[model samples]
Target chain A: MGDEKTQVHFGILGCAEIASKVCRAINLSPNSILRAISSRSIEKAKQFAIKNSLSESVKVYGSYEEVLDDPFVDAVYVPLPTSLHLKWAVLAAEKKKHVLLEKPTALDVGELDRILDACESNGVQFMDGSMWYHHPRTARMKEFISDPTLFGQVKTIYSSSSFFPPPQFFETNIRTKADLDAFGALGDAGWYCIGAILWAMNYKMPTTVTALPATIRNSDGVIMSTTVAFHWEQEGTTATFYCSFLSHETMDVLVLGSKGSFHVEDLIIPYEESSASFNFTSGASFADLHIGWNMKEQEVQVHNELPQEALMVKEFSRLVKGIKDSSIRPDTKWREVSRTSQVVLDALKLSVDSGFKRVYI
Target chain B: MGDEKTQVHFGILGCAEIASKVCRAINLSPNSILRAISSRSIEKAKQFAIKNSLSESVKVYGSYEEVLDDPFVDAVYVPLPTSLHLKWAVLAAEKKKHVLLEKPTALDVGELDRILDACESNGVQFMDGSMWYHHPRTARMKEFISDPTLFGQVKTIYSSSSFFPPPQFFETNIRTKADLDAFGALGDAGWYCIGAILWAMNYKMPTTVTALPATIRNSDGVIMSTTVAFHWEQEGTTATFYCSFLSHETMDVLVLGSKGSFHVEDLIIPYEESSASFNFTSGASFADLHIGWNMKEQEVQVHNELPQEALMVKEFSRLVKGIKDSSIRPDTKWREVSRTSQVVLDALKLSVDSGFKRVYI
Candidate 1:
């Protein structure tokens, strides 16, 4: 085992837009291989396999369950709509296969907890597929924030991720249907804001949150547009976030402190060609929109041109191979991620139902 | 009546810090005179009158009712704590006097509605003391927004106003008690956010709102911080606002449009000494924030250099003197302002009680 390179064969549950990128990453990596692909339609699965030039070795399955039952697959990536994340993640765990579930792992906390229990009981490794968290820029951001000389004492955080949704995407899709645990901007984009805030605030769930959800509508009636507010606390710090699906593409996160501030421009999907950079404050005096240090100069450039999904897959492979030491187990972090998502979604639901009431966690 | 130079004698209901400037303005203005001053203590009232050089002409009263009852006083300025605003404003109305009440006219809607009714029945002017709304800059801002060639189509509106509160101010103050109509930063400073958003969005009440409020508390259980998300909808337009009292001093308002963007720097309180300017962007093209045809000109300049309270008094004096039109009564705006505040505060309370449930108007 020491001399031999560990190999993990992977299958994808539903071939969504994000799955293609993950598949490409798996095919390119030496430690992992794309063993199978599945979709509700066999034609779609076959086309995916043939297009990737994996038809000779990779199997195509019509039913997601058939892919999960394959003994050759060591892990499965679930990129189904948010509503189905819990079901397939639990099934993969039951089959003794590690699972890499996409962002907003589940729609609510109750379901998320059940998924965690299933994974733990089966001794299956589970990881939330948050590729941004695996990127070097995220670590650099954490480091810059912790540095007293650079940021002084951390104070507030503001983030926004707004983009125009495809016109057809909002009609009866799992992501837009309220009965299927669908929320518009907050569920789709607001999770990023919540995740970023929690990460910067040392994983402290906001003690309370008061949100104003935008009144958005399609032919279908009122959908959420934007959520804006301050996340307050009895202790620690406060943060603010704005998320929208009605605007032009924008992804930025800014962190403010007493002495200076640090921000990551275009955080959602990093600019395709270059490494993400942070703008830090240079001096004691504050100026509008300033940047200070480069992580590359500090020798923190872990991966230069690798795709974000590739980086995440590489990290997950290392964790499964027992080559990486982690403070929280991959399984534990998976549960925590899902739980945090539920807390945020639940709070947002409460805000919407109660006409933007401030809810305490 | 025009030749008579009609004068309206004004009085202070509480010798609060804000009242001092009002006294000075009354002394300076040609159409109004400071007739009386009152505080809980006669000694304090006398000291305030003396400090402002109201020596022999201005009468000092021990109780607030005495000032309201004074026949010489045509209007009374109420700068009392939030809890006392409704009671005193109603009392002043009953005395047949016009009233200028500070922001958060009342903590809840019921109290605000009663005050409005009393003022209407008594035929007295009732204005929320948000004097900044009366500044010439506001008119200029409206003009900029209305001009299609300048701003094109308005898209998004963002505003934030945050400042630290004195330590003693949080202890048992009317602004900090939730049951007593005190509700953290939302009540203290978030009201300004409401006013700014309503102003920018053309005074449209939100069709729906979803908010997340922070649980902010001092050592003695006073709420010190809050963040609120207000999603407003009218026709097809939507706007978002973020307001807090816990963060550092920041006052910024940004309005993004399809063809261009307009930004108001230090919106709540612009620098008095320097010129106030904003940036306008139209797609790839950009220009200085303009009001009508002007570019890079000062947006908010008060040539008189008077305190905000003084500016408010001077404007009210002009209204009384028939030199300025009173048709745009502040009482009309106060109704909406107070109603919005009630909705927001009620939403905050519901959020806290229901563990951050979605609330509706």
Candidate 2:
């Protein structure tokens, strides 16, 4: 939020369960306000708002188009299914509304590129809702991994995000429907895993990706569980990630470097709202043998004034405000990082289709 | 150890560095004794005993054959390179000495079967030197993973054992020599990862093994680092493991189940000598929502009365004593598990050789 001319008012373009979390995040963010909610029916949108205890002033709209048409809404939070992202996100940008698109930003990078192009031409900020990246703990982890003296060169990364959905959700969830999300768990749970891997590698794209075998799928041909390995051939860095909707919930990212290693159990969602933590170990100076045991692990704890999602909302709002208040153009860094993650996801999906073959990125 | 008649005497073959650890294990194991030590040079063997602070009563032999031929040596611990395993292990069994063999147990299943066969024929106990298996922490972790209500069916496992060896080891160590360990990191570090995966799956053989791409190799074409995936088709369980000598030391075994999850960071070697821990989570019943926030992780700690390697020695000594004092046959269970692990490792090595193709078990 700048002077009175620039506050990011958000219109949530669906009453999806995830939208509930974002609405709270918008409320918590100092510069953002949840101004409206939308659904296929106005009654359902009103019920969702009431269930989440939204402000009395928040508007309820029967159609996503109506939310986009509202001039008072400066930004649109697109929490629609993957198939709807390209159309709605592009439309929001064309309408001069900043877009906070939900993840698996589009069915593939082609659609994501089109949306990014729309945002670029329209001078609207574009960012996928990758909330965990905004966590303070992530920044602290980056500092440790980037230290050449302490960590040396990064060699490998292993990330995993899996959760066994309720048995009934498998039959009803849009994520499992081919026409809706299409990529299934690779698009849903795997998106976070891929993002973490790419982020740990300093956004360097992998040369190739190979899907691990025994990918489980539902009758609808939606992937339920799978693993993909990424190789940075020139850098001699490798990464592997596991994603699933059929396994117990476990989120982790482990970065192994020549001189040190870092690990975090709750990478996607912190176990607590107040703080998060990571473990790092830089080899002891006297141990030229590269033994980790000689070094005492530094357990770093990062306290957050607001939840990660709120931080993400605040960051997005700051960008949107910068565009509105100054002659500053929209930041392309968010889109660039999102595109890299999507590219890896597309290759992994291709690898699964090619019988777990190695597909170059 | 056996009042007077049942002490399990031991003869060490080839004064390998790892033998120092096992020699200490033998000393600490109440039922076992280090009766003899062997090296190509008798003076070298004497020097090793003095360096390791061995008792003056222990004998030092100039050759491995002489130690095997010692009638009073009831058992022999073979810490030779993998290329020498099949020959020395069989010869020791033929001499009626129980064989506690260091792992990669053999280069392939055929060689392992030969060693197992020799042990069977000569009525001698056979157990790989997978010291961590005998740790009390392992038993405690097993109970949590096996609980049908708490853990449900194990859906996936991810295990990794990697260490950044000193640069000189690449040129000087037997592990990196093609004619010695041949498989390199796949044999030295990967063996523990594979064993842990198989152990998590209750020793069930995988239907197929697939090598992940970007397997790093040294000039001699030995794998410096690599990841392999295993599929237990009928059991609907999948596992992946990464092993390396070119990265920071990280030993982890993560088991994801339908209802719960378990993680142990130091699976191969505990950071401390006296105790270790594992993290387990059984999700809250009401929140079947697949969000993990409600489940409080239970950190279970296990203290050891003796070091894990010592416990392994005690277990092997107990089995050897059973064969000597009673009408007990050698336990086939140990051979069965070791054989299964070797079969998977063989398939993985074959997969790596076949241009990362899938190799059926």
Candidate 3:
């Protein structure tokens, strides 16, 4: 942080496991600092602070409202359960605190819209906690995909986001409990897949969303796994993604263009924090008699000075700073991006509910 | 060949561009030798022999029947269009000559069954020309997918087979003609996709086949590109594939298992003639806080002494040798594989025909 007086002070609402990661990101960001930690039980919040080795100058609060009420808290990072997002995120915005909400931003677009409305009405910045978007490699991939002659028109896309957790995860994880996180893997793991697909499409809403008939559900009616497809009728582009809680870990995205394609294996999280790479090939064709390819995939490597989460925090804090120091309005680009992803997620769920029918947006 | 008299003799039935490659493969296989070449016209057949630099002893036939009638021709490689497969394949088998047929085995399983029945009744071995199946890398991939502990159960699979042909291909290629290839890209490119998916599933037929609505077609209503899905209801597995003639070249197959996953970018054709590799990750899990993966993908490389096409010829000839020397019956495994792929391909076409509805197997 350049100056304590000018840094965007962050207060974490609820001591969720993800909050610990963000706390470090806030500290790593040059324009942000973690100032408060909150939980329903003050003792638990203090324990989390100690576990994370927070600075002695940081404050601990018994309730999220206390952090919201703190004048020094310039923004609130809400990593609460999906069910609690609409409540706290809206309240944070109502209290004039910039909100960085965790994904599956809300239960559905209805709830997501309400949260966005609150942020817009209160003149506060809003961004979902999809940190992979901030990675330097993602930008590099965008450049290649956007290239006209090298990449050409979009053709088809595929993405997979999955992880096989331990056996006990199905029994007690908050993600498996219906009321705690109703969308389950679709909300947790699928959020990233949908986000990545939409990002590659430049956040354009798909014409139709169809859930494949292979979705698996837990006893509590939470999704354990799913396969879905999106089609852009106008562009003749199609995308499919598989998200699961019961498969080997994977975060892969493959984008095929008319003249080129790219594949990223670790899209949601880099295998390494310092650098990441994706393989791409442009104008590839078969060699004589089709015995071999004329070209091979070229790896594009990108080095990042900080982790993607830190970059996310830095970007959010910069927006907050612009609002505070220059009387600039909050950026709506992030909110729009989150809104598009949420809408697509909602439609996919609708398709699943309606017997895998193709639901038009 | 170790013993010239013991080697299987191959007679190619056409001078299609692909026939030149198989001609070379026949010569490359130690257990097989190119004994004759044929075309509709004697001049074209003579030119093909000279262009391929065939041995001076190899016979040149003005018509396919002459090659089939030749007593020295032990097997015939049919590289004719789909419309001509049943006529020539049946005649070849009726003449006691083994058959090596090009893919999209036939226009449909009905036509395929007729050709296969002739082979069975006449005691002749029959196989489809899918060279990738003979690649050493394919066997290595199968080993991983079959390992119970290392790969576990298959969760989901995806494949893409595509190529951007020159503009003239759209106007004059046999694949674009309705009566010549009928199935177009679905038959030409989609055959490999169907075969690859079924191979990963041990040749089991899917319960349902559904065509995605994003299929593109040429002006003649021949499929230019299409996407399809397969559901194995009993095993709770799903697979999707994209096949096209209007996109950049891509031969990708990704299979995700419960404990492992593998991605082969050059599944249909290797990037090199001598060696190929695929990336796989087994027992993958997220590291603490999900900042990174516990393990990264490992590259497994397989080297081959001869090209995959030559290996295909060798395998086919080995079966022919078994029958010739030891009174062995034809291997039905290859026929069964081709039949299953044809059945699925037919169902996918049915789905497309029925307005992208799900067709039950």
Return the top candidate by TM-score.
3
Q: Which candidate number has the best DockQ?
A: 3
Q: Candidate 1 on A272-321: residue-level lDDT in tens? A: 42465555542332122111112111223334466666777876766665
Model 3 / residue A33 / CA error / Å: 0.2
Candidate 2 residue pairs in backbone clash: none
Of 2 and 3, the candidate ahead on lDDT is 3
* Candidate 2 residue lDDT tens string, A1-361: 3332456899999998889889888888888888889999999998997899888889999999999899999999998999999899999999999999999999888999999999999999999998899999999999999899878888878887888777788889999999898788889889999999888887999998988677888888888888777888788787877888887887888888888888898888888788989988777332321211555467899999998988999999999989988869999899998999999888988988888888987
Please provide TM-scores, in order, for all candidate models, with all chains considered together.
0.62, 0.96, 0.99
- Per-residue CA lDDT of model 3 for A1-361, tens digit only, reads 5688889999999988888889989999999998999999999999999999999989999999999999999999999989999999999999999999999999999999999999989999999999999999999999999999989988899999999988898987889998989889998999999998899899988888888888898999899999888888888888989999989899999999999999999999999889999999999998998789888899999999999999999999999999999979999899999999999989988998889899999
Score residue A13 of candidate 1 by CA lDDT: 96
Per-residue lDDT of model 2, residues B1-361, tens digit only: 3443567999999998889888888888989888999999999998998898888889999999999989999999999999999999999999999999998898888999999999999999999998889999999989999998889998888887888766788889999988888789998889899889888899988888888667888888888889777777786777878898887777889888988988888887787778889988887322322222875578899999888988999999999988998969989888887888888888888888888888988
| CAPRI grade of model 1 | incorrect
Which ten residues in a row are the worst by lDDT in model 2 chain A?
A: A284-293
lDDT of every predicted structure (CA atoms)? 0.64, 0.86, 0.93
**Clashes, model 3:** 0
